[model samples]
Target: MITLATSVFGIVLCKGEIIKTSVHGPTGKISYKDEGFGGMPVVFVHSFGGNVSHWDGIKDSLVQNRRVVRIELRGHGDSEFPKDGDYRISSMAKDLATVVNLLGLQRFVLVGHSMGGSVALQYAGENPSRVAGLVLVDSNGDPKKNPEEIRTQIKNVLFSDAYVETTETYWKQLLERSKPEVQERLFEELVRAPKDMVIKITSELLDYDPTLSLKRYVGPKLAIVTPENDDKFSLHRLQLGFPHKVIQNAGHWLQLDQPEAFREILETFLQRY
Candidate 1:
């Protein structure tokens, strides 16, 4: 039931009757889907190597009672790649700012997954007054914890001729606990991302210091993660004292792996905060 039309600006889709639109961002056109019209707006930013469709599993339920906006990061989905090859997290955060500004969202809840969590933190840190609440899903807050040797190894692999194969293996390992169908779909999306873009983003991400941003935003915060990440260092472990919930039997993409449970946890946060 998906219909599409071109309007000289970008392709607009009529899936579920939601109007898919685009905004002119710092790097290029940024595509996002806006729906619903009640309650505080809920803005979603998908993970690196993912598009807006990554939120499809839970967006409809949230959209029923709240204005929901899902933004696609540059170089992903319909968004154009940066002409200058700027894939830094801060630049991506600016892309988020562009869309939010265009929508005139003065205040709203921000939700981010994986790399998107970093972008959300950056935005909330810089514009703390605008974000009412912040949620980080399976995202790391201190990538600098990784030793230099490990990062060097990762960079070498990313620049090697076997980059695609190596990344495929890494993605598969992350989805080992997910459903077969979920694994298949997500793997395809992750592996298809432009190699150079992925490399640059990953390289910069290793050096990203989310602590400063996390300290700046003093809003209600929550970290939703899977059991596999329970032992890992994260914002939830910081002195910030924000709560975190671990969904059992779920993989990296907990929202897609356990949509109902993920939504319940998310709704609880929205309600309590």
Candidate 2:
């Protein structure tokens, strides 16, 4: 049992916190966090260049209403990296499926950000019934068709060498709104990603074409378009042929950039499901 004593910031954190323990994946352990109880479980997946803590800003709020979980994908945060070439979205989807099955959860919501959202989409596409709903935040549908320079600019953010040396404090500093120490601990445990996987994953992200993957996921999906530092929305609109909601004043990392707005938008969307 996990327990957390909290009344700070008017947030009620229950005892037995059930923090992210390791979930065995195909390659290795996939790290994740969990909290709250008595309602449907929801998993929040962070983006590239981000660990699951990115959702902490809004997690406590969500936990008030439902059991909320976040996962650190392979090669990021505390998760183990794949020694082989199994970082593709399909493989990642399988890893997530294993986690869900292990938890014995049924009828839960899947919330994913950026690349993590890509993995969620593919999974829901194939197993729509298993997913109660989906929340795709600042996600990219296709990058290969993007303007070469635009993709290049975002690439800088993804594979920044700064990501390796930068501690959790660095991420918090960069994010400016995150907890100083908790955020740092997550970064400290991240896999020492190899250069090859970085390049390969970049190719996978940019060229994998999540639009094709979306066609397979038939669940209720919400496309959250971040208005800043994100180009995936337009690409998604054009490629996936769906209408999306725009979050004003939000950047690439919308949850971090506009926590309250993100929380409001998320709750509003989830209410319908």
TM-score versus the correct structure, for each prediction: 0.93, 0.75
* Residues 189-220, model 2: lDDT tens digits: 33344655666676678666766656766667
Compute the lDDT for candidate 1. 0.86
For each candidate, the alpha-carbon lDDT, in order, equals 0.86, 0.70
Weakest ten-residue segment in model 1 by summed lDDT: 6-15
| lDDT accuracy of residue 26 in candidate 2 | 82
What global local distance difference test value does model 2 have? 0.70
Across 1-273, the per-residue lDDT of candidate 1 in tens digits comes to 455545433445554555788877887888898888789899999998888888888888887888999999899899999988999999999999998997899999999999999999999999999999999999875767779899889999999998988888889988999988889899888888888888998888888888888789999898999877666467688655578999988879988899999999999888853
The weakest ten consecutive residues by lDDT in model 2 span: 4-13
**Top candidate (TM-score):** 1
